[model samples]
Target: MDIRQLKYFVAIVDAGSLSKAAQKLYIAQPSLSQQMAALEDELETQLLLRSARGVKPTTAGHALYQRARAILRQMEQLRADVREDGGSESGMVAVGLPTTIAAVLAVPLFEHVRKHFPGIRLQIFESMSGYISEMLPDGRLDLAILFRDSETHGMSVIPAFDEELYVFGHAGLKLRKTATTCPLSALAGVPLVTPGTVNNLRLLIERTFLREEVELHIVGDIDSLPALMAIAHGGSACTILPASAMLHRAENARPPMRRIVAPDMSRPASVCWSHALPVSAAALAVRKAMVGLIGQLHADGRWPGITLRPPPDAATLEDTSGSV
Candidate 1:
């Protein structure tokens, strides 16, 4: 019925419960429930079905949720456009990052945006790449930098770079390192602590190993980056990740890392956003800043172990110019 109610409705649906959404929105549960009730009363329809597990959107609620997201996005865009007409890019842009790369890009990206587009607010969501991909269609995220298995789902994909995987563990681990690289066959008996199958990186590693006839020993399945790094740092198991991850780890203390070779494995990283949703000027500015920072990082050898890839189309150049 109102923009505030629509926002509350969308947040509730995304969080899957009134309590959780209330906490996320920093509002009291009773207040959130009252708002939803008022919204339902105004709309003259049942919007949610309550269950022991959580609340789910009813048929009507589901339709409203989708439209509400679009409405909210457009409203935010309108605000940004007004600011842009005043010669300022000022709005919130949600960026999604994979756990592994979050450590690598989070700070630098923030610093870049702050210096270049002080009027724009950047909200970074760190999660598994699969989860980040889900946020695009739901309107929870305006832009995302993540790994791709060649699927865009009608969204625009701007290739950021290609990152080579590596075997990383404690310094005491017996690794056959030659020129800072190790053969994949050497990992037959090596214990690996990796992300769960829900992660795109994990799936890529599995598929590559299967194709190359290498036996990958799975010692742990961790979805948390800190936990995975702790396991590797404690000499429990080696982790297979991109060079940027190792670079992040090495910042605290240099750990043993060797590039995976003998049929090298790498994954493509890209910036993606939903094509169906209109891109706000704020989101576009943030996107360009991100791409430029990544390019600068790769060119300066700051983002180690990744090869910079060209954008799939010329739109990147067009959108980037004068965006910041």
Candidate 2:
């Protein structure tokens, strides 16, 4: 019925629970419930179905939810765009960040965006690459930093940087220095520690190894990168990492990333956005900032100094002129 009600409804769908959404919105559970009920009542549509586990969007609920997001985004943008004629770029930029990348760059990215584009508010959602990719063309995301760039109908993919994936392991193992650049076959009998089921990166690694017929002795499956690093630090297991992934060493980690590289083993990071919307001035600023920042990071010896993937191929991104 109103933005307030629509927000509550969206939050409920996002959190998948009335109580959780209430908590996130900083409102009482009953109040949030009343708003949603009122909304459904006004629409004369069953927007959601309550369940023991959580709320599920009914067929009608799903449709309204999609419409609600677009409406909200457009309303927000309308206000921002109206204010843009004063020579400042202003709007809400929803950024979709891959988990590990979010952990490493969220703060810095925020700082950069805030410093330059002071009027542009950034909302970051740290999620799996798959989820971000799904959201991009749906008016949910303005941009994303992700790992995979599988072809999407109305989206443009830009291969941003290339970093060497590393093989990480315990201090006690006989890790050879040459393993960093060793063939994927070197991992055939190698024991490793990897992320658990929820981590998409781990899933990708598992599938890649499976396809390559590489049998890795997975020593442990854990969710937290810090914990994985701890086990690796404690000389308890061997794991894989990006040469750019900085793990605090309680002990020396080796063969120090030499074991993870192979022709097909390298994963390129990407920046993507939906081709659905017209590129706003603020989005263009963010895009230029991202390219500059990646290069700057490389020069700082961060992430083993990733090289921007060249253009047009699956290994590259179509370079935008930033002329918009």
Judged by lDDT, which candidate is best?
1
User: lDDT of model 1 at residue 277?
Assistant: 58
* lDDT tens digits, residue span 35-88, model 1: 999999988999999999999989999878767887887787677768678536
Clashes of 1: 0
Model 2 stretches astray by more than 4 angstroms = 26-28, 41-45, 84-87, 127-140, 171-174, 177-180, 197-199, 247-256, 262-264, 275-279, 311-324
Query: lDDT for model 1, on a 0 to 1 scale?
Result: 0.79
What is the TM-score of candidate 1? 0.86
lDDT of 2 by residue, 162-276 (tens): 6556666534345454443556777776667787665666777888888888776786777666676666656666677665445333345423445455544656787787665
Top candidate, metric TM-score: 1
Model 2, position 69: C-alpha lDDT score: 72
Tell me how far the alpha carbon of residue 205 in candidate 1 is from the true structure, in angstroms, after superposition.
1.4
Off by over 4 Å in 1: 23-31, 34-49, 58-63, 83-87, 149-151, 170-174, 177-179, 250-253, 311-313, 316-324
